[model samples]
Target: MLDFFRQFISFIPPALVPLALLAIALLLVAPLGLFAFNFLAIKTLFEELRKIFQDIFKLIIPKKWDSAKTLIWLSVFSWAMSLPTRSFVQSFIAFCGWLLLIPGIHWLMHEEKKIKEFLTIEKILIAPWITGALICFFLFATPESLPGIMVISWPIVSAIIAALPKFIKSGPAYKVPDPPVRQDLIIMVLFNLLLSCWIQLCYSTQVWLAQYPSFQADDLTNSSFVVKTPSNESAVSQGFDILRQAETALKDSLQGQSWSQVERWLLNFDDRIRDLNEQIIDRLPPKAENAYWQVEGRVLPGEYNVQLFAVWKGPSSDNLGYHLAKTCQISQGVPVDRTPWQTLSPVGSASPNTQVDTATVSCEPVTKRIKGQPDMAQ
Candidate 1:
């Protein structure tokens, strides 16, 4: 397919460069794939969508049972193309397995119905494994899997085409046909391929949506500090060792003064985070997708959201002890002994959707839930 594109781009007259470029961009990056070339058409809307999806999913999930041969071919082709690397063998095997896996599933189930009328794990395993082994040893032993996969899909595609009328006879929800292979099986394949490409587009768009706002929060970057000490090292170097080193000096300077130890530590910590943020510049969101930070609530109507400023202030500054002593704005601050403000997410910080507005994590608790590490807080 990529080869075809490479050839296609070379054939266009120089005057038609813009049109060709447009087509290429749409083919590779549009929300829907190169829609025109696919030539997929369906009379029924719902069935069309179903068949289309089954086809589309092949990109992410192979359609092995759709054709054992195609699966093997695909595996071998992929293996070969991935030269300058040797791991393609495993991938080829897996692709072939998946190609046969699902269809093999349905086939064994159909066979079981003819006999026991019910399925057992053993009954399901035999034929698919046998088919997969045969495909690997006989066909995919070479690197023709790319076109091989296309060829392999034909018989399965043909079978699907033949069975189409029967599948729909049962009606929409009752038993929609698996593959929507038509006389133009190539068209169907292309259609599904386009849909898969659309999915990739949406995935990329989603990531952009999530990341753009953070990037825009350039001014907010200063909200987290990156202090460079006279030592020419980040204040954050060696896990707050810099803070600890400054602690004794601070304590000496505060001789007979009444500031609390934890408060002093937090002050220095806050300064550090602030300095980090100062080091980074701020940016605005791109017009393509307007970005903002938002949080969610788990209550009945989960739409309850809290939008935070792009540039954020750390929770440690808003820690119960500090907020109580200095701000006095949040009168009923969280209890000191209770859980700290943290996120349950992988990063251990809350998104705007979370209930916990601020986070405090403790690594030394006896009954810690996160193994030896502290739970993340927001």
Candidate 2:
């Protein structure tokens, strides 16, 4: 068994060895820690911590006023004061929010006392469950401070909201009637589990949107419940920008050249297209696999046309996936006298009437979806 452990440890990456060892140590220590929690020394330490909290609370609050009432009123006052500014309000709200939970739980426990004495309710005072729940609520309420982690906070907040009432009602001290477990308590537990799963699924949809932004551009008429449709500015508009840049490059490099020279440039156009792709990749965020701009060019009489396709290789209802496309047209610019006519001639000799036309490019608006895979480059 020791040799087997050694062999397993060797398979772990060098950087992860310490983490793996720490995890193993935690697994071994957790049961021992739980068993030791009921020891007299541990109880003494907890009692001391409780005294420290009480002392701190007394120092901050005046003895003349009720502590819970004062804290609640002050929190309300601070909230009203913060409404107009909307700046640094989240931090103040978070601080007061968690503090409010102390009185909140106290009120709940006090109300439950009116019914019957529950020994289990007293145990909750020593435990940190309420503290953890309040922290989750604070995180969920103040999204601006930690937006990325808000999704994780939702399920914790939901579970606590669903179970707290039931937890307060079903104390172990309550005598069991005809049924050992109350039907309502069982139903609440099952309902809370389903609610947590639903919350998780909602967050997962948001993750999918982040991975495939084009989905945001799709019809959200039926998906309003799952995802709020953003503004037109946030839609899949990268295809238009990519085509615009490619059109600019075509005009900058191939403009003012004769038809013959332009033909020669087209022969090696694939290299130019490849360079454009490299430049685009460097400028934009890393796209999903096979989801990049693919440009296909066509040569027309005295003109060149190219199609820019924004390919998507991510989750889609369609098997072939989808793409956005825009077409760019390149035409000749006004004629200009060739430098060769003036430079090559003698100083006294008259220059010939030789001129070369330059090229210009214009692109059309992006089509929503081209439906099929992009055509091979010409």
Candidate 3:
């Protein structure tokens, strides 16, 4: 069969052949699938299957099998089939499994209703099951698994389903309004739109939180939404790790350098930090922007103080934003009385002179909640 399909498609252009094959495949499957669904949906077959299952387990299955039970069973089976497999065949089978529910629901809705009496309570009873089945199918087939068009279609489909009940006529003689301009449907649609906006807002907020995790440290008390805020320690953990790594790099690079070399390196602190940022910035989340690390050095009486700050400009309680701080003190292993140049003999001389002392570095605990925004220029 595979060889025949390949030979049959060999006549078409390479670019169009895949599409042609897909069209052919669909054409072949559609009729068979329709027939299978119609056969399974026959009232006698459905009842017989239900009766066999219930009779075999009558002791454990006390309730009579109904539409709800059937829908629930189908949902569970579909989920189970999709959960453990990633193969194309298994995924297709799972897709077919959920589609079975559509025919089942359609059969139930038309089982006891006349064409004009669809607006009756009995017909309306199946609406929730349909809505639920759609929701479950979407949840089972996530955005990543589905095509872009399918993902975009879900919200519109959901809105249409929500408004379907409004079209249900209350009685046989009651006519739908001319032009169909009903206030209830208009309000329902507007509410659906508002609900969509709220959902989008929540998703955007989650993206912000992920990119700028430091925002989780903010005092959300004044905010209207009651969200579960992460602990201060957890929120700043990434910032602290960045600072600590930079401190270690600085110590390793300047460990054995002369005092003058140390001073010169600190003088180009901004350049060194920029290069270091380029090295480690890829570790951050893709959407993280305007977030970086800065290091500054101060020459004390006998020691060098280097303060590392992980600064990020993002949504926070204060619009100014926040930074995490870590201070490290670098000192000479032994007190140096002379410079590296002086410690060496004259250029022409062969005499060995006193050894030049190197700097030793140690950092303190990382601090959180330091106010003020970082200077982007520096």
Best by TM-score: 3
- Over 158-248, each residue of candidate 1 has an lDDT whose tens digit, in order, gives 3444345444643353454446534344564465456545555556644653644222212223444323235432221111222222232
Q: Over the full model, what C-alpha lDDT does candidate 2 score relative to the true structure?
A: 0.61
- Indicate which candidate wins on lDDT: 3
lDDT of 1: 0.37
TM-score for all models, in order of appearance: 0.18, 0.53, 0.56
Please give the lDDT score at residue 58 for candidate 1: 57
lDDT of 3: 0.64
lDDT of 3 by residue, 103-130 (tens): 5555455443452266356533435435
lDDT of each: 0.37, 0.61, 0.64
In candidate 2, which residue pairs clash? 256-358, 333-358
RMSD (CA, Å), candidate 3 to true, equals 22.5
lDDT: which is higher, 1 or 3? 3
lDDT measured at residue 169 in model 2 versus the true structure, 0 to 100: 38
Instruction: Report the alpha-carbon TM-score of model 1 versus the true structure.
Output: 0.18
